[model samples]
Target chain A: MPREDVEDLELELLLEALYRHYGYDFREYARASIKRRMWRRMMEEGLATLSGLQERVLHDPACMERLLLDLSINVTSMFRDPTFYRAVRDKIVPLLRTYPFIRIWNPGCSTGEETYSLAILLREEGLESRARIYATDINAAVLQQAKEGIFPLDRMQEFTHNYLRYGGRCSFSDYYKVYGDRARFDPSLLEHAVFAQHNLVSDASFNEFNLIVCRNVMIYFDRALQDKVHDLFYRSLVRSGVLALGHKESIRFTSHADAYEELDRQEKLYRRVL
Target chain B: MVVGGSWGGLDALGQLVALLEEGCSLALAVALHRAADSPEGAMVSYLQSRCPLPVAEAEDKDAIQPGRVYLAPADYHLLVEPGRFALSIDAPVHHSRPSIDVLFETAADAYEEASGAVILTGANDDGCRGIRHMKRRGGVTMVQDPCTAVRREMPDAAIATGAVDKVLPLDQIAAVLNGLGRA
Candidate 1:
């Protein structure tokens, strides 16, 4: 067999070990991205091959945690795409207002940027008191960070720009207090927020939600995994519940495609119609 | 796959498209650096007019079809997985989210020796490492000659890597691509 084939076999075994031992199912992730992340983890650990890293991770829980962090993409920003937030305020807020209470689920909420952004949006619209936002991620480490709500102070400039572009009604700085290198966000924003670890690959939907914002998370999943999550989302959403994905993500190709109607095609906002 | 960057990329791509024959068999993926929020469907409409092949922005898990050209959508890295395309919103590489390097490197791994990468007019060095990866993986690597490029930094950087298989003008790149399709 070729060297590349041998490496592939090793990678498969590694993923299998990870799933069987750690209950993290990365087997269905897009292979190219997984392969790149695996190689990167190997380099970081100073190991020569995927099998070596796998052995370390399986035996040591710390190693597994480190590897999990590496595999889980934590790239995010506050109101990363301003237009999507604008659509939420312009199009979805009115519908959310009609309800007595709002339950919003933000799966794979890396470091709580989107969660806080939503909290701010709801507060600005005077709906925060009636909203309960559940911010979940597979990685506990990131969930901890999300609960803290502290970000690099330097990133505030970019976040402020995004906030303004998203039609923020107040000064962006009003939400957070900067100290040296870190900026601590206002705790009032998270009063109704619940931060928890929820693995999309393994966990079932716990409750029906009025809105589910899982932007950019599905892009990492393969077709089968994507279908599975879409099913979960379909079951979890209340009638006419809103689902907002990343700018590039869509429901057109999923099994639940027909169940939701496109609310904003450009912003990837969909509403449960059936 | 042909990856171009800033400067005269649009014009060069138009020229290359005009020169290629209809119904080319090779599946083409183009990564051109654009604003993350640029209007979708704009590139498809612009390029479809000049090219005979079907042109569209790549969507997640879309199967790679021959005789078609797929453009990397803005703000997402287009990765070539086995038999399908995957998009990533991971941090931008070399300040580009739809980085030419990400697409080319993934293509090199997915297609191996069967792949051909073309680096065209650009002001950045994003495609240099990707072309090198392609060449190391036994895939064909070509660069637009720096003299003919509107901005020489990109082609010059690829050439500096010493992994480029051909250095041709924009007009001739289509011919080489057609020959690769035949092969």
Candidate 2:
């Protein structure tokens, strides 16, 4: 076969093997991006080719697990995009306070950074005691990291800066214990959390949420996937609930735009409308 | 060469990778520098359609080949081993797995005298040390022109090391890489 044809075949075979063996369907993703990521995996894994990498991933459950980790993006920090978090604090928290029992979802909670950020905000607003936060991600590895709640001490100054920018009222250091090179967050901050594995792409909404924070995660999806996620978030929210997206992401083009009102246009914060 | 970037990185990298020839002689690796936990691949796919090279996510222990583009998976640090790619659970470097530093350093070690490193648009100084290492090891070092970078910090930091061989815009970086690959 021509090298050109061979490469094309390899790409298809690799995608098929991934779906058949791992049950992770990325077949519909934007191919160039998927191809880029898979090829990088090929180089990193030292397989010399995508076909070989696909073969290993097909047969080795551990390799499949690792591949899953590789495919998911996890860049997150507590109170990431401070201005966005502040918007939630100022506009959404007061509304959430009215509820007797509130359920909040931080989908794609990546290492629990945003989850804890929301927890801190809720605590400061006197709502932590009544709220239950479900922090979910498809990657088990990051979920484990989230459970540990340990961050590098060197980053505290920056995290402190972000915390303050988000209207934090206390010393950011008050949230964690400095342990050598690591800072372990106060477990009490997570008292209301139930961390779980959830594939936003493949899974349905499991429970209703008064506020859903899916920041910065949806920009990777194609229109179909984005729409599906929008529907899921809409289904998950109670009436007059809130949905927060990443700064670059918006519901403006989605079919569900009319379902939610923009609470903060700049922050991409929206409130569900009946 | 799989190119991965996030935030200001997308446009910068898009400009860089858009330069590969239809039958280029070198493979590309990318550490998208994104959240470590979101499972979605579209950016590389979009690039592949326009570039002459085939693109895909980098899997652990995958082999390198010319004329192909690779992207690092979300959570894993995409690294270059002796002649292969490997993934690690080691903590995030510069708060990112599939870090630019991790990919460049490991690629420098593996390719040693044969490697080339480019630091494009980024908000942080993640790729500077790696680019420096690549330079010390005889790899060609390049940075996107900080003046033109959407996020200047990354390219600026790389240039500050004084190890970079060229500081070109996105389009120019593509031309340089194509020239080197052809040579």
Candidate 3:
């Protein structure tokens, strides 16, 4: 047919190869964004077509790892949306305080920026000892960086601004020390946190949680995939537990729309009502 | 329908939407260059106050509906699927988030021949390539006549490509769009 249609066919074959060979199912991700990422990686690898990239991905483990990084969409920042964290402090923290212990899941926690931010919030609220954060991602490469808790020092200024805007209680610099081009976060911030590689697509619920902060992750998933993950979240959360999503995300189109009550609509926080 | 503007966009957008009238029978996805941290939902509220069509800032997975208006939320690239809206934080194209190119390209791919693109007063050329792609895909392409635009550069850039199907004055855009929507 058309050349565009041919490219789409190539894209489908490559994604299928990626899923079957790698067990990393990106088949359900949003088409436009995922396709763009595929093209990006293809060009980066000096390959001209999706099929050509697929061959290298299957043959070279190193190629797969690099492609994984792009597909994971690791773009994030400390308190990326400050208002969401503000709501977590004002509205969600009190609910966490009701419980003697707290389990927070940070799914798709790429590079641990927000995970550390969450830990800092917990410590500030004096909930550090009582709370345990399960920071997980589909890519282990990012999880290792998350565990290290170091970020580009250049980004510190923006994160510091976000921290202040969120009404941070202490000097933002108190949390980290500069090391070369990086700023290494205090180890205590990660003491109660565990990092792991968890696949949201095929993995089952491992534990019930008091709060699940999965921001900016599902925007890359399609409708069916979003519904599947929402079901997992619904099952993974305790009754009245909080679910925070990316600022512009909503539960309205998902299967669990009626199951959760809006805790903060603008911030996309929902409380499991039933 | 995909609509794009940059500099001097607000007045042109306001007048265009006001003239589109109620029950226009087409979904309008608009992208204008605005800073990411501008007052949240302020533009949507402003547009809603003047436009006959229902206006709101886009949210993920929002289904595109006829006669409704959707604005690209700040700092995010707005994309389209067959019948819904998708948002992305992917690095900005043409130095703009909610880049006119992103919206127009995806909308053209999804809607194909049924899509229409209108480029209006912009200082930059973000929407030019998109309108060209839209024309190649059998979509209708229109631009505000450069002479009538506040910043003639954007429209002039689009017209230079010879891809625009029609180049109308800013005031006359609504009538052509309404007619196209009906057809």
Candidate 2 versus the native: TM-score? 0.64
lDDT of 2 by residue, B85-155 (tens): 65543457778776888788767766766888877778888887788878877788887777887778877
Candidate 3, A1-274: lDDT as tens digits? 9877888899899889988898889888988878878888999999988889989999999999999988765566798878889999999999999999999999999889889999999999999999999999999899998888888899999899889888999999999999999999999899999998899999999999999999988999998999999999999999999999998888997888999999888898999999
Superposed Cα RMSD, model 1: 1.7
- lDDT of residue A269 for candidate 1: 94
Give the TM-score of chain B in candidate 1: 0.97
lDDT of 3: 0.89
For model 1, the docking class works out as: medium
DockQ preference between candidates 2 and 3, better one? 3
Off by over 4 Å in 1: none
Interface root-mean-square deviation, candidate 1: 1.5
lDDT of 2 at B114: 81
Compose the digit string of candidate 1's lDDT tens values, residues A1-274.
Answer: 9777898999999999999997899999989888878888899999999999999998899988888887665567898889899999999999999999999999999788899999999999999999999999999898888888899998998899889878899999999998899999999899999988899999999999999999988989999999999999999999999999987778988899999999999899999999
Worst 10 residues of 1 chain B by lDDT: B1-10
Best-fitting candidate, scored by TM-score: 1
Once fitted onto the true fold, the runs of candidate 2 whose alpha carbons sit more than 4 angstroms away are: A1-9, B1-183
Give the residue spans of candidate 3 off by over 4 A: none
lDDT over C-alpha atoms for residue B117 of model 3 = 93
